[model samples]
Target: MTQINRRDFIKLTGASAALVAVPSVLKAEIGSAYEARVVVVGGGFAGATLAKYLCLWGDANIQVTMIDKNPNHVSCILSNLILNDRLNMNDITLPYTSLQDNYGVIVRQGLVTDVTGDDVKIVHLDDGDTITCDYVVLAPGIEFIDVPGLKEGAANNFDVVPHAWIAGPQTELLRDQLHSMQQGDTFVMTVPQSPYRCPPGPYERACVVADYIKRVNDGDGHVIVLDPHPEVTIEKETFEQAFNGIYKDIVNYVPNATLQSIEINPGEKIAKTTAGDYAGKVLNVIPTHKSGKIVEDLGLLPVGARFAPVDSASYESTIRPGIFIIGDANDSGQPKSGHMANSQAKVGADAIIRMIASKSSSVDFVHDPARLEKIRTNSACYSPITYDEASFLTAVFAYETTNNSMKLVQDSFASSNSPHWNKDNFEDMFIWSESLFSNSFT
Candidate 1:
């Protein structure tokens, strides 16, 4: 992967001038002549942020419409708190009402069935409705695949074992199960392979659940974290400190525990993995992830592909001409997290606006250095290691001219310093999440 460090980025793009000044330059032209019809599908961070920016940055001349299956987006950002009773479901639930009332975005609720077009695409909804637009931004978050051992016709069947990866009804189910754990009881959860949504998410969930059990159940029960990988994926030192230092007794760290199948017996759910057979009162099997079915159905992905490839600068599909894929669905070499999605949305929104202003395809827009120089994206998220303590991870990504893809800036990766989790970081976690929530939703 081609990359540029902070020092080299400054050498090439003049740091602040390239990242900051170009927005002001683009805003002047975006407000007047760009009368474009853009349709954004999915209401998660990427779609919501994209739509909000499109309306916020573009003037009345730009007409933006958003479509989602749900009336509101229940954020997976901090949904883990729901399990530990630190935060309620309502706290993380984001509504589209503000996008409609505050911004002049047309919010439509329906399932997108099909999208067909070349330059201008027509989006078909399950309700038998069609919307033709000048551009389409697809932000369908992710779809869970079937793990081995599940019964036939039971794929994504959360009734038996609540994955709860996507925050919604299943999240409540898992929350209830976690809350009901009594002394000496066990709670088991699995971590899928890398490139999973929210790299540190499974580890964070283990930490939070362990903390809750210890604090609530008088440190009797244990939380088993079964991981397929040999070690933690992200925030290595911090999570190691958490699992080994504070919550060691409460958390059982089982490495290289690959899920083979599921076994259900009398009043027990067992995860039969390569490590061993471990049973729990409640089992959350986060299956492998893939781009939502829409992207596959639209033939945007290569055969046997998991993520749709896109030009990182513009987030437009390399397979298709006009459709732009953002968030977890696209292969941008970025961690799949809400904050990352939100960051990509800004760059994508700006790219779309610029394309609309210039009447250029995303391929051309990504190639044009003058236009590409205006691109920059940063993704960061704070993980709550405990109820009142948290850890953070951050990275900067920029379009590299050599590779023509988004690459992590060398020496830009930063995490919580020594004693990674503390009270201040925990408090700042909310402030950070609130800022992201407001910027994307409100």
Candidate 2:
């Protein structure tokens, strides 16, 4: 790991001189006198990253509190592999104890029933306690969009077709269905519309599941993908190439096909789709999504009712002051992924630190306007396609300071055949998970 100096960090900002400021250290006693409390909602990738970075980089004058409904988080990033049995759910599930023990962050297991700019009130199911904070970070993840017939199925015939997008029981139900399928039976996968979490996740699931079926069922099973998007962003060519060249006999890819309704035949143990009535032994439906219900209940989203609009520069909600939204919940052009969410959290943390520092009288005289101007830009690096099971293509985008339009700096494909993909990438993931857990719960 390279040590990130303040100068290098500033350069990464892409901001003008107006944003950079000298790092200051305050005595513990002085810091405690005016410590600002930060409350983070949702313990997923974005919320956890922001909370961790704030405690790691911000002044000691800041106290962090993280609130979440679940005590442990199972990452959606790698959950697709779990469906194929490539990875177990334990590999992605992380507890909050590490965050509490390591970072000294106050972690409360509660649901944020309501949120305002200055204070957030959470309802603790364990003991019915309400906790409030000064600054709140909202990263409650996303809620599935109610596709009319889809909800009807979920309420009634959930055993036949399952939307395993959310972790826990839904995931296990889908996995069990796949395991129970006959060797020659068909399996159907439906990809949701754009702006969903992990653009390549559905495709990845298809690949991994196909690989599993080929290995176990001796290439007797068939897998079909129904994509709502006209084309996939990641590995479109490569995926087509693989499907045509290697998995041609077993895998079928259909694009621009919207799934209107799901007709489950319990007698035949099959599912029907909009393209045609195809019988399948198992069905996995990835539905359209919006900001989670908690966020909607808190009235954080805009009039569109899709995502919460925020200033791209700060990730601060336009509708609510002092409340920041990151990850899939925010209406940013960036693809919703754990990697992008982590990057945005760092930027949000830095902005909050700058905002807090600007209020101090001692820093007023020494504040350099030139440096402050330089701290406004943020960038994101996304790995959209995984070439094989190991590596893929990535896009690096930088946000313009004035307009916030994303500029592609590097959009190229890369392969990682080395064992380091598992070694280094897994290590990085654990570090990220630990940091988030600590920040949110400690």
Candidate 3:
């Protein structure tokens, strides 16, 4: 069997030695020019960040192009707050014009059909257009694979089970269902296993929904979270406090509860779970996911649909060079969140710049052999534990460095009681959103 190593592959490309000596900024400029065009597919968190950074900091010589199926993107990060009426959808939705106006990025509103190394051949509205480049960044996010019996109209049931994790229509559907529920009604939320986007999302959704039920229905409606993990990975202390003190009577959190299968009858508005059968006015089933289908189709992913394995530091796919994967699509052990995606985007953008510069110059840039041996990759997630209070939690993990990998680092949890907490968090949320929006779209 032929063996391929990340470091060996980088060196064999003949650009590795030049990459080590080239500065990131200069490399980016060279790659952004016509000579070193860069095509970034998927205008979500990862793609947008990569495009913007490459344009702003990359060598001016490179021409950066960003492509996506949609012109406007609604963020998955803040969509959960919409369920509790904490935020509106419009606040999170952003248009692509900012990328064109603010940054010199060429925006292509189309679907990516295929990705070859250094060449992204796409089909736009049934018309084909191929863009050749020095590097291709694949950040198409994730797609929920249709399970055997978990798809719309799969079992002759018109009833819909919304996985609001994807944002947009599915999110609106879940919100509508929640609002339509009567008092004393029940809602079941299922959390998928590890390696999914937003490790804290399912728990955060439960908290927000429970808060809504307490306010509107006076603790009449019930929320049961069926978690596959042994314990919640985020805000555990704060969540426990919220559940015990605020929604103690309303929410039932059942850990180690996995979904065996589902029995849905649309006519009767009924569903059955492994834990027990319940007739709820609404049901939210967030199933397992894999890299977006396009990744697999382009032969960028490995055998299993779990994730795209890549060089740990650079995020360049092991299967192909000149192709990078970030966000929820990559096999990095980090929690799949917009924050981490942005971080990884920076690393990927820098790596691509180095690779391009090496190719242009005669210098032999040695790739870092120890780049993948880093100690920690951490992400912080903030969840509203109460109507006027929220908790900031951070999870840290040592990837490929230690056997006992996962570690939880608890940040300060601020309640509404603290005047400073509310003020700071409110300002922080807005600034974070604006920063991301400005960096990506603007």
Q: Count clashes in each candidate, considering only residues at least 3 apart in sequence or on different chains.
A: 0, 26, 18
lDDT score, residue 132, model 1?
Answer: 87
TM-scores for every predicted model: 0.93, 0.79, 0.81
lDDT of 2: 0.63
Candidate 2 lDDT at 140 equals 89
- Winner on lDDT between 1 and 3 is 1
Q: Which 10-residue span in candidate 2 carries the lowest summed lDDT? A: 378-387
Candidate 3: Cα lDDT at 227:
80
* Collision pairs in model 1: none
lDDT of 1 by residue, 55-75 (tens): 877767789999999999999
Against the reference, the lDDT scores of all candidates come to: 0.82, 0.63, 0.66
Model 3 TM:
0.81
- lDDT score, residue 6, model 2? 25
Which stretches of model 3 miss by more than 4 angstroms? 1-34, 117-127, 152-159, 266-274, 360-366, 369-378, 395-427
